[model samples]
Target: MTSMDLSFRRSNLLRNQPIGRGDADPLPLLLGQLLLRAGLPTTIERASSRPWASALFEGRRHSIRLHFAGEEPTTQRARFIAGLSEAEWRLPKYFVADITVDEEGSDSEGQWVQLSALTIRDW
Candidate 1:
């Protein structure tokens, strides 16, 4: 009879290895483009994502917190918020089905906008 030895290794040793280049998720890039379209100096405070699926569709649901600094005039900020809700997104391999932007709150520092969106895979 022959015996075989199995060795174990630390998970962290493999964690830093690159699986592939350019295979990273494009969600961050898409979000950046959205902000750029708004033409506002925006800072992302927090973002969360979850996988979403239906009988025939699959995609992700994202909740993003954006901050517009006080430097921008109030009218411009209001226009940004209004336009963001109605703008059409042309993201690669993704289609934004629904989106909502709401004023979370504001202070002497900045204004906060909460954006919720549902993106469906196009491919």
Candidate 2:
């Protein structure tokens, strides 16, 4: 009878080494990449019905508020609102968000629009 040596298998060492690209802010770039997925392109209007995003629902229920800077265009704001509702459109995760476009006020810098976002996962 031949004795099998298990030392070789035990000696095999592997580690989960995550390579880093040293990106300062990769969210925006990643979002742009997600937008390029091949299919019916994510238009400004048909945002809710796509496989990317869910329509945001606001009511008296489980809710949380998040703040994100918006752009200077109404159309752009709308696009973000829709995208924020789905996990696919907004890379990373998904939640129902009430996106309110704030008026350019004393708190806002030049051309920097503020969007008050409230996210609710479920009723």
Candidate 3:
């Protein structure tokens, strides 16, 4: 098997949920789970409703940071890189970004809150 094939197999093992088979976004899912672990309500439709939203979502700033060990090919890593790249490309062309962070580092951390500011109004 090729290195890419081996990497993919390893990545899938680390995933909690299967790929392309969930109703909700993975990032949001993780955020919800984190909130629950912190004794906060996780069932809320909007993560912004929680107090943490203020810290994550400011006026208009979004950032995504990635941290990983030495350069070793893995399926999950490859998928993550590809997926995030796709998200970034689709972001500016199709979606509006209040803020976004695309960087790589060892000590990476970030937060994003879902705000209700943007909404469709009947004209």
Best by TM-score: 1
Better of 1 and 3 by TM-score: 1
Q: Score every model by TM-score.
A: 0.70, 0.24, 0.22
Pick out the ten consecutive residues of candidate 1 with the lowest summed lDDT: 17-26
Number of clashing residue pairs in every model?
Answer: 0, 0, 10
lDDT of 1: 0.71
Q: List the residue pairs that clash in candidate 3.
A: 7-74, 7-75, 8-75, 61-99, 62-99, 62-100, 62-101, 63-100, 63-101, 64-101
Expressed as tens digits, the lDDT of each residue in 2-113 for candidate 2 is 9876654432335433223211222343334433431122321111111222465422112122222334334433444454434333423334344444432222321222
What is the C-alpha lDDT profile of model 3 across 1-123, one tens digit per residue?
555544455566687444433222223433333333323211223333111124434222222223232233233234334433223222211122222233322222222223221111111
- Candidate 3's displacement at residue 36, Å, is 17
Per-residue lDDT for 79 in model 3?
Answer: 37
Query: Which residue segments of model 3 deviate by more than 4 Å?
Result: 1-59, 66-73, 88-101, 105-123
- Residue pairs with backbone overlap in model 2: none
Whole-model lDDT values for every prediction:
0.71, 0.33, 0.29
